[model samples]
Target chain A: MEHFIETIGRNMFAIFGVMALVGGLLMIASKSAIHSVLGFLFAMLNIAGCFLALEAEFLGVAQILVYAGGIVVLFLFVVMLVEVSKKKEGEVFQLQSRYAVAAVAVGAAMFLAVFRKAFFGVASPEALVLRPELAKGLDVAHQNAQAVSRGLFADYLLPFEILSVILLVALVGAVVLAKTERV
Target chain B: MVSLNAVLLISFLLFSIGIAGVLIRRNALIILMCVELMLNAANLNFIAFARHNGSVAGQAFALLVMGFAAAEVAVGLALVVALYRRRDTVQVDDINLLKG
Candidate 1:
């Protein structure tokens, strides 16, 4: 039974990880802004799934709440407000296709170089194993949210407080920038 | 269990796709979405490493990154909206007022 569960979990991770990568690619390839937003939504949800697969349930839920709920909505609102449908369809991509090709090639080369050295060559398989101490806190019996909150309020209190201030500044900035001046 | 390498590879692929989108897309909104994708990729890395190392710090950092990403998107979209109003289009190529 345990082995069966492990297999299912591994498969879930593979599926969601591929979904995220493909969704990101679709976002890039789509011409319509709406389509790109949809793709971005798909990618964000799958990344949340990947987070769950990694056993970080709190972060996974936060991913859905913050990203899928908040960020994607913001993107959609801007898309609607901007009148992107009015732009000429052919103008979706910049004229310099050559630069895109070069950029993709460079990105692919970087991936291959790192993959070859890290996974296939020097890094041992043991490196992939979860450390026993970390795994102990994350076991299925423990409350992930409680653990996360404990960490946030105790060890990470300063950053937590600063994040709230940063969020406030961003809120003010957005309002100032998006608000139209009244005559 | 899924290997850490597999998870990291997925993140890398998403990040690379994001880079391509930022380079190729003309619309500022799409570019911003692509940047979000890249940020999510980094968040995935942080989570995966956190799991592998058996530490909560990775998850904490990921949460922090998420907060920062939210702030960034809010400001970024506001800037995009302001730019569109000023220039009448979101195409990056045409908005060359700041070009040096």
Candidate 2:
């Protein structure tokens, strides 16, 4: 039983690791609009699994449900609706040379700093907080679902409702913006 | 034990590539998709930190980021739809309606 539990944990981690690599590569290499959306979905799946490995099942579920299911579909629908028929001839972007270089340099440096902090700096503790029952091969996902519901109602009530309002506004705004101008 | 750093490093690289695509791609829809990539990269970082910290705050923030991303996508796609209606082209180079 213990061996089974350990194997499951390890397999989950390994899956996330490989998914991250493949998803990243695909997202980078995708030139087509549809391919990029699909790549992002794959990457989201990997990230959600990583959240599970980190013991945040609530986040893992939300990541898959909201990001992969909701956003990617919207992207594909929009891509299909808008046609890019012209040849890729003229410059598509207007990034200033110095600003672009600086942006990349700063982003890279920040990422490295963050990476060091996460893996090697003062914040390099795993701080594993597993419930005893959870470590004993019991399904954490079920418990997490209950806890997530309690958390949402108890502590996260306001933010939860606020998000719904935000979504409503966005839907309305999208309709308004997409409305054609009078002839 | 696979370190969180490894995951974060991959996320950063993905984000950089997305930014590059946004900068280099002339297709507006593709650029929007790249922007989505960038936001997802940030969300991954948030979830990793959430798991490491044994805190729910990271997940909360990630959800907020998701909401913002969704809203951004809506408005952005609407803009794309609007642009396509006005100019009949979705290419960035083709959008010169405002240029003098």
Candidate 1 chain A — worst ten consecutive residues by lDDT sum?
A: A120-129
Candidate 2 lDDT over residue span A31-143, tens digit each: 66677678878877887887777666777888788878887888788777764564443553455666886888888898788777666333345533344543355343356
- The DockQ-derived docking category for candidate 1 is medium
Comparing only chain B with the true structure, the TM-scores of all models are 0.97, 0.93
Proportion of true contacts reproduced by candidate 2? 0.45
lDDT of 2 by residue, B33-73 (tens): 77877887788778677666655556666777888888888
Off by over 4 Å in 1: A1-7, A95-104, A117-141
For every model in order, what is the iRMS?
3.5, 3.6
Report the TM-score measured on chain A for model 2.
0.69
Task: State model 2's lDDT.
Answer: 0.72
Which residue pairs clash in candidate 1?
A134-B54
Cα lDDT for residue B51, candidate 2: 60
lDDT of 1 at B7: 83
